[model samples]
Target: MAKKSSVFICGNCTYQTSQWIGKCPECEEWNTFEEQLQGKTPTSNHLAIKQLEKERPKLLDEIDINQEIRTSTGINEFDRVLGGGLVKGSLILVGGEPGIGKSTLLTKVLGNLSQRDVENRVLYISGEESTSQIASRMRRLGIENNQNMFIYHEKDLENIFAEIKIIKPKFLVVDSIQTTLSPELQSAPGTISQVREVTFEIMNLSKNQGITSFIIGHITKEGAIAGPKILEHMVDTVIYFEGDQNGYYRLLRGIKNRFGDSNEVGIFEMTGAGLMEVSNPSEYFLDDHENEGHGRCTTCILEGTRPLFVEIQALVVENKFGNSRRTTQGFDNNRLSMLIAVIEKYFGISLSFFDVYVNVAGGMKLLSRESDLCIIAAVLSSYFNKSLDSRTVWIGEVGLTGEVRSTPRMDIRLRSIQQLSYKKIITSKKNLESKEILVNNLAVNNISELKNIFD
Candidate 1:
């Protein structure tokens, strides 16, 4: 009797579909199509009651702001990612693989907050762990359980909200969002729809209730935060706790930060108990290679706004067989090929008959173009069996024409070098023109001049 009802669908990157088709326009997953009841009426989400509540925000000029109210998490690296400190009414989403220390990091933050003498009680809602499992971790950590830190073992979203009302805690945490379910939806827990609904409600609560909430989200096989992409979009801040489980070190990257700069990342090491902060990263990167030779050199890489000194090792040997091998770790391979091409074309090194292997000393990956100058310098130094001065630094972008290009944040980079007590830097002439750039010594804008000095 009624006209055919239209089916609800995923318009972008659709993992699910409404009907079978030759090509899937959403998400490009051709056959991953599942249909649900199309005619069901959508219900008003009671999960997000906090957002539905009435509040009138005053104009900025009319309200007096407290600059000191932004709270620090007691971890310098974590605070850096959060852009100074935690803001009230901000929602943060953290995701990683199982046994990756996502829960451990959050627990550490909560432990510190529990020690504080504030009216705000930290509510840790653990939907995954039982009371006994949580107890074991606390015992291993050698930290006493907090009387003010309230723990819950519930998974129902409605009940979780009810507990929020009863406790009226200032800070809230959901150990994981996937385990929790809402009563309004007929779909099973962990469904795309349910995940989206639950997170939406939680984010709304943080804004309306003035509660800073931390939500631990599950990761997909692709290593991205699971559930709808919207789950990440809805939150004020999104961070990923990532590392090699077999390795000792861990990395935290801020993918989306509404309050602060997003490029910042924190590095930590996992101990027998919990994660210990890496106060001195340079020491961790340095290996036992005290003996130096022609093929080895030291390089400084710029991570975000911070500069870290690292060692680069290169090996060159004659290849007897055809198809010479060129391998590199931490440094990109294609970029190495480009550099080799430059060496052959510009310097006439004839590397096509040899095997070259390059590696950055630690288990770190270099992402920026600032490492270009150092990498090329190392390759050339090894090929010619020559060594560059260890006390100096080289930083510049390598153009296709084999010319060094100027990099951004030169002044900031110089300040980092000063802290490390480096004496000299070899860079492009464009950067030396700025009077504000004050370094200990200047070796600027003369790539040709630098080689001539060594000659």
Candidate 2:
């Protein structure tokens, strides 16, 4: 006989309780607790021992490395973010804000993959959209309705798995795991329990059948995948699309990858013909050079193994209110405040009476602290109303005591700057020798030295 129990579970954090509560103590979210009925645990443990073809474990040198391979989606940007290409039997999760081009990107990949081989079958099961809706998008993307490409509107996990078993597709995509549910669970779609179970089934199906699967996930209001934290654990790779929805730019960031590097990022521009890869992101971000030095400066930072140059702009105005407002776009707000405090304490510059605004060009967020020097220089330039050299670049971190710190990959950054035809570069004097370099490299030990160079 099956037994049922009543429990309260938090939708945000998956915390369980015997009784319902107004707020979740773990996530501190109010009105996120829902009452649900729990079914008895199944007798068969899915993760337990499985009866299959067993092979003896071999030593490190005995195994052939050539057996494992990756399939290219024919999209360079997508392939770059996946650390070369998609591995067979890998489960990848893509999450982002609503209307962030997650579906569009995947649709384009499907089209490209289908065009690569007529015999390769790809199935895309959309639980949130109908066949007609997907077809309309395909037409807009100029993707032909080919025989190898398949689309099915399904929300039932059993039916989806049945179709997968029958077709034996080489590639699979689930529009979203939230809408797909199991028949045995009484919980509604998008619930924590339902999402967890559906993802587990998909993972098992992909691994057991050797199908490369891409699962789309809805994000929470906080911009995280809207399920238990373990949801990220079950997948082989997890990437998110980031950028301004209204803008033309999109950043693909890989947070977790079992097959490749996780710190890598891919840049793309959204256009009428789907997403287009940005071959030279530095040129795209620094397209405007008319008013370079007044409040703008360039800095290079490492994104995985690649070095990228981005522009930073700052503006200072007299404060109209009691408290000076500090606003930042594409940079951390708290970090801006801390930097302003450092400027005031060491340089004796009083930004207390001014409203400060900082922006990173092209709507891209910066996760590196190497841009600290450029950001500080832009602010000081705007404050003093001085114009810096247009062909100059700044690359270093700033300490609380007004010292400039060396950044990682100094040679790579310097080479990139020189390649871009920058006349001068500012960095720390710790370990670099610039006697043989073509571009003039000025080394500074502290922020005061940087300020003196401008003075």
Which numbered prediction scores highest in TM-score against the true structure? 2
Worst lDDT 10-window in candidate 1: 5-14
Q: Rate the local accuracy (lDDT) of all candidates.
A: 0.75, 0.85
* Candidate 2 lDDT by residue in tens digits, 1-455: 75677898887678999998898889998877877788754333332113224458899999877755888888887888899998998999999998989999999888888888887789999999999999999889888858888999999887887787678788999999889887758787887888888888788777877889999999988888988778999999999998888899999999999999897899999898889999998888887764646788888888877788888999999986759999999899999998999889878779888999999988878888999989999999899888877688888889888888888768777778778899988888872654356788888888887667557
Give a tens-digit lDDT track for model 1, residues 1-455.
Answer: 86653333342243444465655675664443434344344465455663375668889898987764678888888888788888999999999999989888887787787777668588889889986777667667764856777878898898999888888888888978888877776666766676877887888888888899999998877787867777888899999887788989887888889988886778899998799889877667756545556666665666655567777777878898868888998888888888778667766568888998888876777777766767777777777788766656778777667777787777777777777776677777786665455455554443444465335
In candidate 2, which residue ranges exceed 4 Å CA deviation?
A: 1-4, 11-13, 21-32, 42-67, 320-322, 431-436
Off by over 4 Å in 1: 1-16, 20-42, 50-52, 56-68, 288-290, 435-455
Candidate 2 lDDT score at position 368? 82
What value does the lDDT take at residue 76 in candidate 2?
85
Which residue pairs overlap in candidate 2's backbone? none
Which pairs in model 1 have colliding backbones?
Answer: 13-27, 14-26, 14-27, 429-445
